[model samples]
Target: MEQRLASPLLQISGLTRHFGGLPALDQVSFQVAEGRVTALIGPNGAGKTTLINCLSGVLEPDSGTIIFQDRDITGLSPHQVARLGIARTFQNLRIFPRMSVLDNVLCGLTVQAGGSLLEALLRTPGLRHRERRLKLTALEALDSFGLGDKAGWPAGALSYGDKKRVEMARAFVSQPVLILLDEPVAGLNPEETAQIAALIRQMRVYGKTMLLVEHDMDLVMGVSDHVVVLDGGCRIAQGPPDEIQVNPLVLEAYLGRMSATA
Candidate 1:
């Protein structure tokens, strides 16, 4: 009999992070397959954010290996990781408050821009061409998220949900291989949440892979291809949403907090 090989787009092993004497993440390990949505769920203080930070290069783990596209990117800087085609949205919106929405999205294209300040100042043909292309691509990204009309609006003036949508647009403009979303629907009303969920499904249709960290069970169950449950800085269970919904460990972790409310 032949053994099948795993084709994971992202893989982690022995991921651990400690703060002073407390462990925020402990021996965490998981694989995110290409072109599928993987949801990371856990209660407060379960290390979900810490794990994402490590993965996105916002925080370095005490020990671990992060392999993406078969490259060892562990300990890379955030910009270095972004250049490697990994983009992330924060739990709190990180948009430029005073910039126009279109300009905010244009920032994602900086890595692809031509030459340098001198070339741009001299109005070189190459720099001009790249700028034109970036603007067009930025418009298309905004259109996909239904924000084309708000291109000139100041990012600070947008509502919470629209700000989140803009952040998603900015992340997508870079054509990332994998996207990490942290509490994307947090503080949104049902209608806005549903809209964001729809946008996520649209990205899946485009074959975009994602790792989502969210507290909304309904959204997680509806969109996730695989669910990884965490508790006290450890992975308790991982499986399809259906299996995760009924897993004893998952149930126990959420029993008191979610069972009564969900």
Candidate 2:
């Protein structure tokens, strides 16, 4: 189990999104505790992806208040949210095909760079020093995921699993306060899933807050400190894995049939 903090790191109240007059997320509310893994799981068309998009600033919620670390961050731009110590990986891998593995990770660290415009323009000693330091840091991040040897290769040249690891390295390099992982194990084999699971545990060990949207129930049950379920864009159930597993509403959401006890 994750060692969650005393107070919520994120508080979302009355979060709603719609398209063409159809609701995608309807009055969703939840609190993600700091230093814990919160799994967001639901059936198909449950708006899990949409919620992640809204949180990461990819899609604005029609109405809601998103409070992160005690500040209202609703409607912030993507870069603005990122600079505030929020980072994410997509359900689909987003990478520059031609960029080297190292470069892909390097791009994420740009937000943490410390060279003033004048120093950069002058190519001062300080600017060069920072660049060298960034390279070393990037290399160290890659090495942690066993990708150091492949850092010179084009990102597109790696297998899908390796590419995901690179994306994870990119997310972790900056040491963000929170990471939103969308379907992190969506298309991997058992071996690859195990690899990612191990890495997720490593992130927890380092005290990272994670909001996960994934379909792998076993993975969610094994790794999540808390699980929140959604159905037709509304939050239906939330608790530890065992409680969620037995919740009649959850079973009905996925099976489309309510139990006699429900």
Candidate 3:
């Protein structure tokens, strides 16, 4: 495999998140390289979600600098960050259950549409053309995720794994430069997990950078080019899979508890 050299797509410096008096994330910092999959792994309650939430503007960090593509976006709103091409899928699936899969994906493209609510309601000529293009794009995204055939189906009718896949399709429909995936393969069977992993690898080929917060060690170790391990809201280790797998701190953080039980 040929390696591509590119600058970091995301940079975090001294990021801290606190819930009242308890700190969930403490000055955590890392960089997500362009066109590469960076895995964020940690034991439960290690603040992975907190960090991601702050990065995605779901939560505001107390103090920190979040730079994307060299622009400071530390306290930007979620909508603001998203408009800058930073997209994310939640740890819990957040699809519109009552909507069709195609419509669910089409929501991602609404940011690019040009029109007021009245124009959209009236189906004006310009808005109609834009809607047609968005639908085509949404369909293409679904096809890429192997869900094109189910485009018209209600999202709630899909299996859990399929819903997860649909969420991924919706996130990518916006053509984001950086995508944060939170436990994307959670609750998936082996086959579904494998498919999701493959899809993640494919994203790299498509030149989309990924920051994956996943607990499945096999998937993280197998597909990630770099991995960051967190424990108790602090970074324990960060390196390639080969190094992360053997780091004593990482092993101690995850496997040490198992050993204590044993």
lDDT of each: 0.87, 0.85, 0.85
lDDT of 3 by residue, 143-249 (tens): 99999999999999999999999989878888998889999999999999999999998988888889999878899988899998888888878988998899888
Question: How do the predictions measure up, each by TM-score?
Answer: 0.91, 0.89, 0.91
The predicted structure with the larger lDDT, 1 or 2, is: 1
Q: Model 1 — which ten-residue stretch has the worst lDDT?
A: 112-121
Off by over 4 Å in 2: 1-5, 112-129, 255-262
lDDT of 2 at 25: 98
Best by lDDT: 1
TM-score for candidate 2, please give it: 0.89
RMSD of each: 3.6, 4.7, 3.6
Q: State candidate 1's TM-score.
A: 0.91
Quote the lDDT for 11 in model 2: 90
Error of 1 at 204 (Å): 0.4
- How does residue 247 of candidate 2 score in lDDT? 85
Worst 10 residues of 3 by lDDT: 112-121
Please provide, for model 2 over 1-262, each residue's C-alpha lDDT reduced to its tens digit, 9 standing for 90 to 100.
2334478999988999998899999999999998999999987778989998899888999999899999999999777788888888888998777888987887777654643333434556765667777788999999998899999999999999999998888888888898999889989999999999989988898899999898777889888999999888999888898988888888878546223312
